[model samples]
Target: MNHNEYMMKKLYEEIIERVGVGIHAVNQEGKTIIYNKKMREMEAMDKEDVLHKDVRDVFRFQENQSSTLLKSLQNGEEIVNVKQTYFNNRGVEITTVNNTFPLTMDGEISAAVEIATDVTRMERLMRQNLRQTKTDFTFNHIIGKSSEIKEVIALAKRATRTNSNVLIIGETGTGKELFAQSIHAESDRSDSPFITQNCAALPDTLIEGILFGTTKGAFTGAIDSPGLFEQAQGGTILLDELNSLNISLQAKLLRVLQERKVRRIGGSKEIPIDVRVIATVNEDPIDAISNNRLRKDLYYRLAVVTLFIPPLRERYEDIPVLIKEFIQKYNELFKLNVKSVSNVVLQFFEAQSWPGNVRELEHVIEASMNLVNYEQVIEFDHLPYQYRKSEVKMAASSPEFTESMEETMGLTDQLALFEKQTIEHYLHKHHSHITNTAIALGISRQSLQYRMKRLDIRVQKI
Candidate 1:
């Protein structure tokens, strides 16, 4: 070869090395002929290790799975964007998306060339997300066995069988997202992405761009990237707090649902989507429409299959079970061995209204557990001040009991008793932080310490 041919050949080699993609080729014998630099890095092998080596001997392929490259060469066909997982020379797992083509010379197959993009990270992330979706939002998360919740969960399970849109209606903290996630995990698209976007979290000005995506220069700081809809292709996209979106944005979302396509903000091209939409409303859909917070058109579109999650107050029978679940959770979390709540405390938990739903009940248990140390039973007195203040008063009848009758001790003793309870509760609330607790009690650090000693309240762990 002349100098010009050698130079041209050298230039081609350099271009292939820096192309940022993995390229590999093999002869009809299935021996590696060309392995680019990117391919070596992706496979964690050197050129010397791969070149002239049989793919079957170098890579670990399962006995059942077909090799896309060999398949293409055998059929003289092209396989596009196919994923392959195999162990490399160093026994490291590798994943790649490949476009394999059969090279032809004189109307006969000569070799096979494979263009690959390493997707090991993407694959792992997708699997991690799938695990999280299943783990964090399974039927087990319901943590209740009441008929109201059971009925709703049954409906949700049926909703998962179709690709139709779902609208979950419930009050706040009633586990709307939990049902959405459970449905996604049980659906046909379980292997794909499960993205959640709260309509309230999106800015009004950029809601369009964020939901539909934006092209570079569409607006200041706009990026040429896939939006939530595109990113959740072949999976589920959960629109949380659906009523928080304005009517105009709701209209755009309805259009996307109706057309099954999305156009980026300020862009003319439309991209088709195959995503299962699950929207949540933290209020009655009828109330939202009447209040002008939600559009009726959007509601009708999203509520193809509507589900209502009953609040924890309505599931009174589930309180004891919920309390047990929370205790077990805190046992694992706080590294304690708390076993149960006292019978009276259980009665109190069941009687009161949990306006915040199951979440409020959980919080009460968590806070009460923090006050315990190696204790097996949680009592009413062990609960947070808000809960026990009433319970203690009702039980004790009054703060008149003292070590002695002690004439003229009535009002002063009563005031001291109130002060003692207030200081102790504030200390625990602030996690034994002297400065913060003092601030909360509107007293100085020295005064708090003096009061603690005078009231015989022991100092807890800092």
Candidate 2:
């Protein structure tokens, strides 16, 4: 070859080897011809082991029938963005998004070239992102003027003065993390890292390593890595759905809380850490303890300061305010000028049960805004399909049989009656399971029991 052709070929090979993606090519006979540096790194294979080898012999496909390179070569076709996951000869699993096309010469297929992007690190990053939270919430951002919520806010503010571990109990989507973040923002540790992990987001085996650092040779593919505790040094780490952790891990967590130190998964030495932990539970703490999902001793340690966020249903007066705030938020987010909701839509929203709590309310408003035109009020027609159909489920006015009874009762008594009826409906619907009923009512089991007693209601066994 001439010097210019040789230089050009050398440059092309160097560029392909150093590229970010894994590049592999096979001859028409399915022999491994060109495997670049990135490909070797992605598969954890040595160049000497893969070069000039049979492609099928070196890369062990989970299913031979679904191999992209083989299929592209056999059919003389191109495949784009096919997700392939398989183990190499060393049993190391590799996952990649692959694009394979048949190389041609003189209108005849000569080989197949495959370009793959390793998604292992990307998947880990996505999981970490799911567990991470960023909040700009403080006491003033809590968005409620009701007396009940104001009382809760007062208690939360009191918690900011101390550095004790806090346990926040609330139903799903009741903004437990918001309260956690607000406390962190107001506390002495506000300047430090505010890391978060959802305890239920991972399996038990993985969750342990993620919370406590993993040591080298701890297990297969395990490296010496700092866990969330180390990452949140001198700061606060929020463990959402803390009750989802099993009892054994809970014991380890208890030790961490008691000693203020954490030992890596396979290490003998303990590392001292100064981190305030804030844990959240969607179920009633009492029920969680009874169900063995939470260790009583650990609960005592974590609940040194407890905060209970009341649900949207209990603080129904906050609905209108929350709706207005959501409207303003979507106006800025979607860049539309939605003014207000129709009176009929507002009445329906206030009367309907929000099973998903505040998050659900936000979704409803955002969806309605998407359907409404700019500078127009959101009418019932603009509501989501399910919400529009919910109007048919609303009950008609009271019958004449209760008219005389309603006259004698004061407003407080009438409100109490309404509350009792709502609780009863949820209790019966959930077959009287305290946990389920309390969750449906968006209150803790203890609070639900108190309401039941105050209203003179009895739960019959199903």
In model 1, what lDDT does residue 11 have? 98
Q: Tens-digit lDDT track for model 1 on 25-108?
A: 999988989899999989888899989988888888756876788888889999876678888867788887788999999999
User: TM-score of predicted model 2?
Assistant: 0.64
lDDT at 164, model 2: 91
Best by TM-score: 2
**Which pairs in model 1 have colliding backbones?**
none
Q: What would the TM-scores of all predictions be?
A: 0.57, 0.64
Residue pairs clashing, model 2: none
- Candidate 1 local lDDT, residue 271: 99
